[model samples]
Target: MTDRPLPNLDHWIADLAPALGLGDVDVPLRPLLDLTRDVAHGVARPAGPITTYLVGLAVAQGMSVDDAHSVVTRLVEERLE
Candidate 1:
């Protein structure tokens, strides 16, 4: 892949979701992205996606997305202390 700039993430998701049969999926973008940044910075860059996957699993298991995101962010933030 070239280093071309990516499209807006919300746009990408909007296009991709229905294509994957997740047309009704609603993502809380800002909070989850914030969690990604916090995990990447406080832990390591590679941990970001892994942390996000765990959050996704929690959401899939019936936890609220916001709660899952907040739980990871708070854990990482407290770790930085």
Candidate 2:
């Protein structure tokens, strides 16, 4: 239950994405990692996963991943200012 990512993250995601029924989807791992890190640091540590989940929902509802990331990043930046 550590926060550290697996050493072989690409392999892990390859196995995990299909298992989660997203086999055909290309996950933007680096952007997501960056988003979570910002949310965790700029907000609360516990907010990281929640914010990521919301971004996923936004994408599913037709928002582009980049747009979703931008929205969340903006919110974090504003909160930190």
Candidate 3:
């Protein structure tokens, strides 16, 4: 995946994040992507809108490229709750 600086990231995150939960978590793009990838792997599921948000969070967090992949992979099995 190509990494590009998110221009409307904050707005996108705010819109994507569900109300009455997490309270607008300002996750960096790196963590977000990592979380999504991990979530996918954890559930053996494919990428989706949720995963996109995770990627955004990861990039926003300033996570390293490789770390983003690893951390997000961890989320694959996690229950999003």
Candidate 4:
């Protein structure tokens, strides 16, 4: 790998989203990041990506992002209990 620094999140997303056919979608970065952090800490490290993928699937299936996040957040909270 080159020694170039990685792009920041906004720049990275701007470059990547269109390539992934999500050019018009407004990605809510903070909440998703928070959710993944919670999942990684409260559940398992690997579950972070898996949970985010599930949330993405839910959004594609017509569930609101907030609702999907709420659901997963609850699950993580419960799991930590």
Q: Which ten residues in a row have the lowest lDDT in candidate 3?
A: 72-81
Tens digits of per-residue lDDT for model 1, 10-69: 688888889988886777676677778778989999998899898888888999987887
Score every model by TM-score.
Answer: 0.78, 0.83, 0.33, 0.86
Clashes of each: 0, 0, 31, 0
List pairs with backbone clashes in candidate 2: none
* Better lDDT candidate (1, 3): 1
RMSD (CA, Å), each prediction: 5.1, 4.1, 8.5, 5.6
Winner by TM-score: 4
- In the range 1-81, model 4's lDDT, one tens digit per residue, is 233444597788888989998886688887888888889999999999999999999999999999999999899888878
Please give the distance, in angstroms, between residue 39's alpha carbon in candidate 2 and its true position after superposition: 0.6
- lDDT leader: 2
Stretches of candidate 3 above 4 Å error? 1-47, 77-81
Q: Rank the candidates by lDDT, best first.
A: 2, 4, 1, 3
- Model 1 weakest lDDT span, ten residues long: 1-10
* Model 1 TM-score, 2 decimals: 0.78
Candidate 2 per-residue C-alpha lDDT over 1-81 given as tens digits, one digit per residue, 9 for 90 to 100: 336665688788788889998886677777888899889999999999999999999999999999999899899999999
Error of 1 at 54 (Å): 1.4
Runs of candidate 2 with Cα error greater than 4 angstroms are: 1-7
